[model samples]
Target: MKVVIYRVGQNQYATPVESIQSIERMLPIRPVPGAAAHVLGVANLRGSVIAVSDLRKVLNVEEQAFTPESRLLISNGNGYVVDEALDIADCADDAWEHVGEQKVWQRGDQLIVWEDLQA
Candidate 1:
């Protein structure tokens, strides 16, 4: 399957390209009261209001300040903030190794966490 590989802190992750609508630059987000802790809030992108979530918090990683490399992976009308958009590659299904609950892929020294954005 083809996947969009992204970074969160020093770790890398992958989500299927088919599940992503677009990869966009970080947009201005308005915080919503009483929202989930992992949710950054909503952003207005091209006249569409979409809720943004912190992939760092979702992955239980340390949150870092948004940098120029920060990107939003838009999926199902929602956005997930990631450290950077690294690459898009075709990965064989047999390449994935299940570690407990996570599906991980090894690329030399780097390990990419495979995720289903639709989940």
Candidate 2:
């Protein structure tokens, strides 16, 4: 199925484009107590409180300044946040080949796999 590809750390991940709500510019976040390090904070989206996380930090990626293109991809059902939502690409089922040696945590059908930049 065609999916939206995005970068986290040095890896690329694709999610079905239909699952994406909207990509919004980085909004001001209020700090939360006792939250994880990766959890940057929370922002009020419309009237709801949406928790924000630095996708780069969560994936142990190098930090960079938020550019005009920097966005927050709100996924339906999942409360997770994405760093910069990259372009949407077409990825068939056969295209998803397993890359050995690297371990990733999968939630439901979402395979959080790491892609080698060198390959």
Give the distance in Å from residue 3's predicted Cα in candidate 2 to where it truly belongs.
Answer: 1.2
Model 1 clashing-pair count: 0
lDDT agreement with native, every candidate? 0.94, 0.64
| TM-score of every candidate | 0.97, 0.71
User: Each candidate: RMSD to true structure?
Assistant: 0.8, 7.2
lDDT of 1 by residue, 1-119 (tens): 89999999888999999999999999999999999999999999999999999999988999789999999999999999999999999999999999999999998788999877778
Winner by TM-score: 1
Q: Which residue ranges in model 1 land beyond 4 Å of their true spot?
A: none
